[model samples]
Target: MKLRFWGVRGSFAMCGREVLRYGGNTTSIELVAASGTRLLIDLGTGATELAKLLMQGEFGRGQGELPILLSHTHLDHIQGLPFFTPFFVKGNRIRIVGADPPGLSLQATLQNQLAPHYSPLNGLENLAAGVSIDTIVPGSTFTLGEFEVETALVPHGNMWTTAFRVTADGKVVTFLSDVEYPEPEAPLPEALHLARHADLLIHDAMHSDDDYQLRRGWGHSPARAAISVAEKAAVRRLALFHHSPDATDAMIDETVWRARAETKIELFAAAEGSYLEV
Candidate 1:
């Protein structure tokens, strides 16, 4: 299986010189298995670019059917749906999987994004991607092509979010977005179990210790908090993701260095276009 990152920023897309090193695209990743199955994670601003990439490769081929698994309905994660090019093209099948929170259903969550209050994509017919929505129950296990996925609930404000543990080609890859690690409690059981012994663990590290303290309950993890979770989970590799909008590339680099300095686990700052083979 090959894991490719299209966007890695958190909350919103970062731009200008301050974030050039880390990139400006928001959360979106593509996981391609040996059997040619494609799994898209998140539909952030980055998804627009990934959709373009997919279109470029679509010449002389049939419509591409891709599974888009969303962690939640946060604007930063699902805002790209309206801009995703494939959705405007007929025959392009996109399967959207997400959980519904108290205020909305899975379908309604997406509808809210496209409603008049947001944009002109107020109707499903306005989209050409031929989308199919599926609601996934958190804590349940499912299969997509040859990949086996286990979903678990995580603590997020108001809206419910999920952490995914995916197993494919004998490799385990876990993705945890917008997760908070409560302080003073050595290991966060939910995060640890999701990432435990995985070949690659992509986690949210949207703040530093100080920032985290100031933004408590915002549902984001500090860099050190993520590292501690990785350490306790015994993960082989950890990629810190969902960078805070204020966190520059340099700061992210520093955070990566600090994590490496503090632990033996291989640590990397998730970047756009980064690819990992497992």
Candidate 2:
């Protein structure tokens, strides 16, 4: 399996020379299985660039089929869907999969984003692609193409974010973005289960210890929290992801440096446009 980070920043997009190395776009990831099955995680601002690249391939010919797995409908996570290029192409099949938010269906949540007052496209119906939305139950296990996926609900403030564990070609990768560990010293049971013994753990590391104290109730984890989870889960490697919008590249480097001192596991910050083969 192969994984790529298209965007790493969280909360919102940021840009400037200070953020050039780590990147400035919000979260979006691309994962491809050995059998050539491709999956997209989130549709953040990075998707705008990913869209441009897709438009040069089968998606450009309107003969592409892609499955998008969403952790939640937070603005930063779904904001780039309207700009996803393939949505303007007929015959491109797009399946959006996610757990619905409180009192809302997955489809309804997305349609709300494309509502007349908010989007120029007016509504999801106005998109030219053949789009379908699937709402999955939290803690469900399912198969998509060549991948076996397991999901668990992790706390993200009052809302719950879906943490995904995907296994393909005998390798495992767990995505635990936007999750906040209630107990700073230990990993949540659900989050630990999803990340247990995975080849790679891509986790939310959106704050530093000092920053986290000021935003305790915010739906994000500090690098130490992520390191604690990685240690408890015994994952092979941990990729600190979902960087804070206000964190400059230098800040993130410092965060990684501090994190390395806390854990013996292979660790690195997720950088936009970087890929890993597992």
Candidate 3:
């Protein structure tokens, strides 16, 4: 499998000199399973870029379908849905899975982003006929093309976000987003179930130790917390993601470096456009 990061920032998007190298778009990841299946892990601002890239490929003429497995409906995570170009064209299917918390359905919550007051377009109803939304059974296993996916709800504030463990072509990749790690204790069973022995672990590293203390219930994890979980899961590589909107390239680099020194597990801050093969 291969992975590409479109956005790694958390909370909100930002711009300016300090974050140029690391990027400012929110969380979204593109995955190419070893079997050649294309999958997307979030629809944050970065999804716009991935959309453009896809436009230059098979989806350019709008002839295929795509699956977007959401973590949650947080604005920073799903903000790009309205801007994704494929939805505007016919014959291009977009299957959105996973329902957010409270009570709204997955399709309904996403339509809210495109409500008349928010945009001129009339929400999901305005999209081409190919777009569809499906809700999944929490903590259940499913399949997409040749990829086997295991999903479970995670602790992410009022909204229920999902963690994914995907295995394809002999490689295991786990995605952990908008989630918090329990201090002084192992990660929850669901997380452990997904992450154990993963070839690559993409985890939220939106805080530092101090930041975590200040924002304990914000549904984010610090470098230490994320690394500790990675260590416990025995994942081979940890790509710290969902960077704090205020974090600069230097700060992320230093944090990743420090964590790398403390453990044998390979660690690095995820940068937009960077990719790795598994």
Computed on alpha carbons, the lDDT of every model, listed in order, comes to: 0.83, 0.91, 0.84
Off by over 4 Å in 3: none
Inter-residue clash pairs, candidate 1: 87-128, 87-129, 88-128
Higher-lDDT candidate among 1 and 2?
A: 2
* lDDT assessment of candidate 3: 0.84
Best by lDDT: 2
Q: Model 1, which residues run further than 4 Å from truth?
A: 59-62
> Which order, best to worst by TM-score?
2, 3, 1
Clashes of 2: 0
Error of 3 at 93 (Å): 1.3
How many clashes in each candidate? 3, 0, 0
User: Which parts of model 2 are misplaced by more than 4 Å?
Assistant: none
Score candidate 1 by lDDT.
0.83
Model 1, total clashes: 3
lDDT per residue, candidate 1, 28-78, as tens digits?
Answer: 989988887889999999898887778886611437788888899888898
